[model samples]
Target: MTADTSMTTVKVTTEARDRLAVLAAEKGQSIGAFISGVAERLPTAAELDERDERTRQALKKFGIALAISERAEGEALWAALDAGDDEALLKDPDA
Candidate 1:
């Protein structure tokens, strides 16, 4: 990997700076390094939306053409999962 030795300053509120510094110290990283790692790992709303669409597309490709038809259905699915009844989600591909 090519190493680029460059530095940039960012301004934040004192509270934010202190909080970030504490978090960074806990992880044994400098503030800049910690922020860079977070940026690399965290997904923005648009990124999440794209991921959701791609997941739906993959599911559709497997013949699960119907997305959860309603919010209630989604909640029910979650309830099933919480109760360890996830078999409700499995279906014969031909059906």
Candidate 2:
């Protein structure tokens, strides 16, 4: 790697500076090095898109499972209510 002698100035809020200082100290790094490390490790747009898609798929699967469970419970409740079985109506069908 070539020597990185370039310099740039960044403006940040006092609170942000304090937080970065604490984090840099914890990692035994200078504030500039800590910030540079973070910039280098940031996820690409494609990686973020893939993560979002996976999350959406997982949520969709969960929603389908929840819908199926609700339908089963509703059917069980209606059946017990129609039969006038109070004990059965209060019981969990999946238990």
Candidate 3:
């Protein structure tokens, strides 16, 4: 990967700053070096893509369950909706 030489400022709480300072000193690294090391460990594109795929699958399953629940009748439908039971909505007889 190409190196990112751009510099940017990040603001954090005083408590967090102090904690990071101590951690950096303990490791015998400059604050910038310590922060850079932490940034380097962040999720890559493939890891983010996998996370997005899992989230999409979960949402698709919930949507299907909600649609099935939409077939419920009168009070039962209202009850399920009020109770926020997506699975109960899927048990509708006419669905």
Using TM-score as the measure, which candidate wins? Answer: 1
The per-model lDDT (C-alpha) reads 0.79, 0.79, 0.73
TM-score against truth, every candidate: 0.57, 0.46, 0.43
The list of candidate 2 runs beyond 4 A from truth reads 1-3, 47-95
Worst 10 residues of 3 by lDDT: 64-73
User: Comparing candidate 2 with candidate 3, which one achieves the higher TM-score?
Assistant: 2
Better of 2 and 3 by lDDT: 2
Q: For residues 10-71, what per-residue lDDT tens digits would candidate 1 score against the true structure?
A: 99999999999999999999999998889779998788768767877898899877454543
Q: Give the TM-score of candidate 2.
A: 0.46
Clashes of each: 0, 0, 1
Q: Could you give candidate 3's per-residue lDDT for residues 1-95 as a string of tens digits?
A: 23878877889999999999999999999878799988787878788667666765787877833343333354586788789887775784565
Order of candidate numbers by TM-score, starting with the best: 1, 2, 3
Which residue window of length 10 is worst by lDDT in model 1?
A: 66-75
Candidate 2 per-residue lDDT, tens place, 1-95, comes to: 23687989899999999999999999999999999889878978787667666765787877833443564577678888889887886686668
